[model samples]
Target: MSRLRVGLLANPTAAQGTAHRIGRQVDHLLRLAGISVVDLSGPSAAVARARAEDIRDSLTALVVVGGDGTVSLGAEIVAGSPVRLGVVPVGSGNDFARSLGLAVNDPESSTRALLHALSRPVVSVDAIEITAAGHSGPGHRSLALGNLNLGFDALVNARANRARSGHTVRYTTAVLRELRAFTPLPFWMEIDGGDRIELDATVLTLCNTGMFGRGMRMVPDARIDDGVLELATVSGIGRRQLLRLFPRVFAGTHTSLSAVDIRPVEQLTIGLRHGRMLRAYADGEPRELLPLTARVLPGAVRLLAEPSGSMTADPKDSQ
Candidate 1:
């Protein structure tokens, strides 16, 4: 048989030394497996210049070596294209990568798992499309394979981006710092003609996959190919309540809490009361705020994963 052509799009800033280490490992492994690998690391702006269709025409699969944001960008490129995607989880919150049963901490094992894909068939997964009317330009939307979060979750992500400290310290510190000043916002959600549920919420997340923020199971029962988005929200809960409920995300039973709600729907619209600049994040990167619609873009991307049974980890959720 012939060699399979592969492409990689990585985030250069995820970990201090992630780029160099992951690049060498993946390149060496795939080459040993007789596959051609193309590396695309550095500025994401380059994605606009690179023709994904042209790359897809030549490559058998495209592998991403960064965080959810980088993978989401790859989804935008391969949404309607033919190339399958492989993810090497080397970023600080490898949520989607974790969901893929890809190794989050073990580079060698993950590369071995990825190499297995060369002889395997591709798998299809669901994604969400978030459309927002921003301050300028045509209204926009981006593809997200893991989660679309609003309110407090968005605030945490924003802080993580602005943090001057290191990754572990930055995210945790931001969460604790924001908790002191985090003000729950009132928003309205309308799902598929369902009555609008008004809420003063700390966090409202529409989850496609089961994990986020380094294995936080915000949506424990979420399944990417289920043809629906699992909506989970924590309304106006106090810090004590958050502490009480945080562990349940890992087992997914937090939904039973009076303050938390979990439901599934095909589409949903979120709007703030006074139309404030409510932050929104899709797959961990900041996107435009509310006055937006989130709809399911089914089978939007092709991903590589071991067959379901070979996948380890209890599907237990703690979100």
Candidate 2:
């Protein structure tokens, strides 16, 4: 058998450590596995900065070590290519890893689990392609692998950006602060030529995977290989309703709320009716904004996941 060559796309800020420390841990683990590991350095600007084509050309598998943003970047870069992608959840919200049954928080265990996954069966997962105009007054496209969120979640992400720490405590502290001042934005959505829904929504989420921030099940029925996307929308509601529905998301049981509208479609476009510069977030990172097209990329990525991580048996999957 050919030896496994792995490429690591690491983010020290997201890893909650200095670059040197994170690099040493990664290098030591990969060496222990007898696998060749290459470190992609520099700022965490975009996957393009890593010279993705070269990594794909040389590595047998590429592993992303950071939060959902880095994972999303890796997904956009390696999907549609033949390379297999692995994830080591080191960031604050390891949402995708939860869906894969990968344990969170322990680096040593995560590394071993990922190495074991590399030797197991592989599965193809879906990704979402988001097309938006560049802020530089030019037209361009952006891609996201996880959920695309608006309103409250976007606000939470923005607030977290200003935080001094990158841990879960920082995220929760920001969420509490944002909740006190958060308000929904007026927006409209069109799904697969369906009727338009106008709403002043607290949050709008498009889910390709079932997990959301820190394991919230905003889209309880979302599936990674179902060839469709689940749009979970929460209308403007008071603090009481919001409080009641928010905590239940961690258990994938948020569909109980009356204000939620779940729509499954192959494509959708979202726009702000007033042309205001509203914030949008993809995979917990900010996006340009409204008037964008989201297309489904079915089975576009080959993922190395724990043998027990398959969502095929979950009855809640949105197929």
| Per-model tally of clashing residue pairs | 11, 1
Evaluate model 2: give its lDDT. 0.73
Instruction: Please report the TM-score between candidate 1 and the true structure.
Output: 0.88
TM-score of every model? 0.88, 0.86
Best by TM-score: 1
Residue by residue across 1-319, what tens digits does model 1's lDDT show? 3467888666666655575567677877787877887765555435532745456668777777767777887787777666777777777777887776677756678778877765566667788988873333223667899998887878888888887776667877778888886678888878976898788888788889857766778876678876789888888679877766656776767767788878888888888887677779888788866867888887777776664521322233110
TM-score of 2: 0.86
- C-alpha lDDT (0 to 100) for residue 111 of candidate 2: 82
Candidate 2 lDDT over residue span 209-241, tens digit each: 757767788876677877888888888587667
* Candidate 1 residue-wise lDDT at 299: 71
Q: What is the lDDT of residue 216 in candidate 1?
A: 79
Question: In model 2, which regions exceed 4 Å deviation?
Answer: 18-20, 46-48, 133-139, 307-319
